[model samples]
Target: MRALFNDRGRAALDAAQDFCTTDALAYGPLRSEDLTADGSSLGELMTGPVLGPLTVANTVGFTAPVAPVMIVHGVHDASVEIEQSRLLAQRWRAAGAVDITVREFDFGTELVPEFDHTATNVAAYPEVIGWIDRLVARA
Candidate 1:
């Protein structure tokens, strides 16, 4: 998360941006199925020797103190489940973060109408702007 990069805590951010973020790495090694589904070459690289070993939970854990985080994810996300955001929020709380929030959106196909894994930034702009205004005012 961008919040983790701030050295001066919440004051360092005018606002924070978060899209579909995964709380935990998916189980097991990368499979050909993942590549075909996502069409990402990066997925293959992530499973390679360089990034594969670093993909573990412990390696991906977030613990730094920073600005308030506003996470937005689609409820029916196929790439990363919404539960991952929930779990990440839990982890942030367990680690002593109090200014984190998660917002779920609905968008998808007819069969699974809420299954949108990718949403445009415009869809969340208003909320993001409001969040930034509030945080900036507080700062």
Candidate 2:
């Protein structure tokens, strides 16, 4: 998804970028030595305030919407793991969402490695359109 960043969003992005660069330089490159060191800076980066909070928030159970929901995830997506969508589907089912479909496309079957995030809209365009058409027909 794309975000229309206003002033606050831009400021947050700038701050995150600055923090990442500074941390990377201070900690040096990610190596076995660095990871197994006394204080794991890479570990800190992974569990830091920015990423940690988002990770927790995503996994936390919440009341799902009372509407038909379709979740599509690429099996080989490196950016966002497929488990994210799986967990979301679980939460939706628990929250009483009746018409929820969780679709997964294997690597190079219905998705491409290069278009990890946009595979649903790009490589699987026809399937997506067909899904929407079926949903509309049901409605």
Candidate 3:
């Protein structure tokens, strides 16, 4: 039982590392401590690290033709807040790019009940696929 728990702990750590690495890769190095410190709001932290890339990504509108942009975001995500994706969706809509969908889930972090940092996104994959299907079928 101890071994099983150990393995799970390691897996969770690995997932977190991967998540951080991916973010840095996309948006560049972040003052991770500042973002995680007490009294630091997620929205404030995201203003630079996340929103900067989003602005660039949406500058010319989605070139793929209303390709049913589906953002599977964890509502309680600590690394990246749902508001980031929510803002993205809103920008996409403003760009006249219809058929964008943002889905939220409750599984990501195990240690922090409020932070869903784990990759339990598979739980919402089916519904996300259906959303994409409907968007694709639209005129």
Instruction: Predict model 3's lDDT versus the native.
Output: 0.58
What is candidate 2's local distance difference test score?
Answer: 0.61
lDDT scores for all predictions?
A: 0.58, 0.61, 0.58
Per-residue lDDT over 16-133 for candidate 1, one digit per residue giving the tens place of the 0 to 100 score: 2232233213222344333332343455645755557667544432683477888888776666778887888877777888888778887663563333454524467889899999
Clashes of each: 0, 0, 5
**On residues 28-105, what C-alpha lDDT tens digit does candidate 3 reach at each position?**
444433334343433453455655566556554444335557778887777677887787777678778776766778
Give every collision pair in model 3.
Answer: 108-116, 108-117, 108-118, 109-116, 109-117
**Please, what are the lDDT tens digits per residue for candidate 2 over residues 32-97?**
223322343444544655556665676544777777777788777765688888988998789877
TM-score, every prediction: 0.54, 0.55, 0.47
Between candidates 1 and 2, the TM-score winner: 2
Looking at model 3, residue 53 earns an lDDT score of: 67
Model 3 alpha-carbon miss at residue 72, Å: 1.3
* Candidate 1 backbone clash number: 0
